[model samples]
Target chain A: MTEATFDACIQAILKGDKQGLRDIYDAYLDYIYRIVYGVVGSREDAEDITSEFFIKLWQQADRYKAGSGHKAYLATIARNMAIDHTRKYKKEVLESFTQESDDDVVIEPVSSDNTEAEVIEDIAIKEAIGKLNPKEQQIINMKILSEMTFQEISDILKCPMGTVTWRYREAIKKLRRYGYYEES
Target chain B: MKNLEKEYKDQIDREVPDLWSRIEAGVDAYEAEKKAAGTAPSSTPVTETPTNITPIRKKNVISIITRITAVAACVLILAATVKVTQRTKSESAAPAADAAMSEMPQNTNEPENIQHAEEASEATEAPDYISPITEAEADAEPSNSYKPIAGADSDKNASPSLSPSESAVIKDPVTFDDARDDLLPQLEALGFKLIKDFVFEDSVDKRSLSDDVISDDIDIRVASFTDSKTSDKYYVVYTVNDDGAADILIVRKADNTGDILYTNPSYKNK
Candidate 1:
């Protein structure tokens, strides 16, 4: 998970070390997939994008210059691929799901022992996050979902550091207002 | 700040695991496919120099140079023809206008009024003559003539998107040329061919402009070369912003499976 270890795996991948590729995959696959899923908003699309991202990795493995945070780099690739997939298919996806009411739309609830409680909490939190401006939602997603640092998020969002910080704070306040962090 | 950061991090931790798993499976599948294609596997050892690699580099440089020259030649020819036509029009038309002016302007009594009327008439006729000439000149210009050179030139000025340390791996003096040369054809095989140079003003933030943004931005250009036969001719151009470390924006196209075919990551116009 450390940057050094990750870089080593990348080096190994470049050297055509199959085990290295697997190791890199094992370490960060979940992180990359989740980030893609967050953007694509569907498991199927997320799956496709994730696959494409890695295929890209294989093709351009030589191009992944080291010292660029390898995991961050991979995450970025996944995120872009997912977004592109969504854009390409947005019209079809929107039309297919148009029949479903907002209230009927069910997102997977967080996994925990308190399934019912967590689902209620998640709904409240998601709704609160949804209420925020689009920029805020993006900020939260970049910071939380993508695990991008403030600086990285700032670069991606093309905003001042202070602005990223403020948006993150505001989004958190809104989510907390919905009792997102209230221990049952 | 620390507390808030921690809280946000925890929230992300809770939401991310499930989604991450799905992406992992997708990457794995993609990697598996590349292995089957005999495209350099990620794990391919770098120790031995492959004999086939030499021709690929040479071919890439030649093709890129040829594409550039061809586009430049087309533009120059178009410009020359336009100039010739403009000269002919001016030669034939100016005398006619001058003769008409001389025949009408002998009286001095109403000089101001006459001059005003003549000037007004010339204003109306001027645009009429000039507009068509301009349009004709524009029409004579080959549309795709500027494309390849623009891409090639932009590649020269593009910022190094990868950090120095990262770039160092390929910077071995002996190998840099080889590496640069190797890059283009590998890209070509992916189904992209350089077409034009473009400057993208990325107002999107650094966080939002993740590698995904990089890929998607490139894909937008890729999608434009819509020919099914050129599906294998993927082309990409990339350039870094002059002022910021805002990573280079590459325009790329891919083959049918959407694999990247061409990339010029350093295609910023100077």
Candidate 2:
């Protein structure tokens, strides 16, 4: 839904309109679910987190400001909730991470005649990313996959913006060494 | 800032979408459970007062009650004072009259005269004492008053003291339930569904008040629920006091009833 429409729905819900809540769920559930999935890295975990996110929305619906993008605000809430879940269930999350192999982490290559080349490129990049320290790997992933700005990455990782820039440079240097990118 | 850094940034951006999609799916699953449990179709009205009361006729009813109590107290006090004064006068006058008669030249047959004078004084003083009380009551009547007692004395030649709007608010509490019930069908016809039934309470903060005037009314609160599945919408119900104006607020869900996305107010009802 358009931001204007989403805002209207939020106002309705804040006013204690049940239909507004239902409408919001039906309209933007996929977009919100996707954001939660991105952070939690598991369908089951994402589903659970998404549900919690909605409940939080209902509880705090009145706090939403009209002009602010509702989707972005909700995404931030979902990300925070997912992080909280990860912290609470750290052991399970770590086990799940260890079980998933490099191949499991990589996306299935699209049907192109150059699929083998793309797969090789993905493998090389993934291995190079894996070789970095965990914090460096997170910085790279958040910048690249999450499309977060340097400032946003710094905020998310609880580091300075300069540190985020330095980390990305180091990760990119490692990727280049692994033949994942051309050296300039 | 370097050339190599620039090259890598381009590559990362090109490859990010696929990875992001996988990450997003994982988050969706995690949130679904919480959303299911929290979105239990509550029928409570949402309000700033925390009492789930849709702002309506509660204020009017409270004002009427206050007016009635104030008027009743004034009437009672005046009546009691008049009764006490009459009793004391009769008690003192009996002795004084007997003393005066004792001083008179042996008029032993004056008992009939004394009885007739007592009766005549009582008949004259009763109306005189009551007239002022009635006039004071009329003068003390509330501005824009709507008390039903005003109507009760109409045929008895009492003044028409209540304004139209005041009477409407006073009479509203009795008809409020029926009026609200009757509107349910109209609300349903307008596409509202009933959800969970719950009572709401409002709290008063003394520190939040700037004035010393305290309210003594207890607010009665209720909630109604409805969903627009086809439009993927939900509405919060509210009714205004003047003209019984009804409003429904719209909300949309994020995914599978997991999260609710509040569409901005500007886009609602369109």
Candidate 3:
């Protein structure tokens, strides 16, 4: 969202208006969801955390400083919340959820009646992303889907900007090698 | 690359379920919990009416209690005055009656009455006694007043026991190194030890009155030490005069006021 619009939404949230929170959630849900999904690597867990992320935003709306970059603020909070969730739950729980989703994906029928171009593209992209490691996937999601700058990603990751750019370059190279990029 | 990014964003958007309902429910629950705890800011006005009515009842009960206390106080004052008058009359009449009267209350009631009267008179006279000191304090308050608060960290730096004249300044002009060597022993003799030596060039910007302390053309060195005996911090400024002799200046760093104690007349330094 634009800075002015975000500030207005924050003012409304501070005044205990639910519509303000809804406006923020509507504007940034896809961006926040992608960042959370990137870190947790599970759709169910991402949805749950993304839901909690808005609740946190509603609760901490007063902490939003005016004229500070809102996208970076949201990205930092979302990334930290996702990391906290992963640390709170054991590795085996997340793995079991991923394994169950993978089993569902394998068993689902892709017949001519139900198969569409978008579904096929979605499945193809999902499988291509599945091949990339979690770090590379996180960088790709933050860099492309959330439209975050390398400096912001580095700040949230607490690493050097050069390392962030290098990792993003490596992830893009790996995606290209996987034939995920379409040639013009 | 743009097409691939667009595809990924669209897929994630399709996958992320709408959570506005859950969020609204959570917000409602949070507001409800805060309202139950009486901490909800928006609900405070609604709750204030009932709270405002109960204080009226409490005020009545408090006033009644205060009236009873005032009556008891008046009765006690009358009893003390009557006893004081009786003791005066009996003491003037006969010394034998004074011994009998002192033994009558087991000597407790007389002393307690006298103590209560003294305490009441002191309480009424306290403002009169403190007013002169308060005026003096107000007059001295304009300049950085040296009164250190009790139990404050600044108490470590403010030594009320040591007068400013007690701070030692080397009288004769000596070489910079020689003066510094002698200055440490002199201050140590006065119960001070070296804390740190600060570079003169770096500390020039730190002092507000740098131009008054030393001329820019002169070479100088600065060292700080604390008087362990009096808990005062002192800074020794060693400056080489045009005659090839160093003039020493001692400044008190007590409470960061940077008050100069003694300056040498040989140099244009304060």
- How do the predictions measure up, each by TM-score? 0.35, 0.32, 0.41
Off by over 4 Å in 3: A90-123, A133-135, A146-170, A177-184, B42-270
Better of 1 and 3 by DockQ: 3
Model 2, span B1-270: residue lDDT tens: 223334444444343222233323433443354335433223234433433232234655777999999999999999999978864654344433323223211232333433333233333233221121122333454222222343355432232343434434432323445545533433332223332331121242321221111111111122323343233322222222223422212122212442221111211121
lDDT of 1 by residue, B1-270 (tens): 123334444544455433335435555666567546544344546674684355456767888999999999999999999978864654344433333333222322333432333343344343222221122333443221122222233442232333434322321223323323433332222222332332222342332222353432221211122323223333333322222111213323333333322122222122
* TM-scores of chain A across candidates: 0.57, 0.56, 0.64
A38-66 per-residue lDDT for model 3 (tens digits) = 76768888989998999888888888998
Query: CAPRI band of model 3?
Result: incorrect
Top lDDT model: 3
> DockQ scores for all the models shown?
0.13, 0.07, 0.21
Instruction: Give the per-residue Cα lDDT of candidate 3 at A124.
Output: 59
Q: What is the C-alpha RMSD of each candidate to the true structure, in Å?
A: 34.2, 31.9, 28.7
Error of 3 at B237 (Å): 62
Query: Which of 1 and 3 is the better model by lDDT?
Result: 3
The whole-model lDDT of each prediction reads: 0.47, 0.45, 0.57
Better of 2 and 3 by lDDT: 3
Write the candidate numbers in order of decreasing TM-score. Answer: 3, 1, 2
Candidate fnat values, all: 0.30, 0.12, 0.47
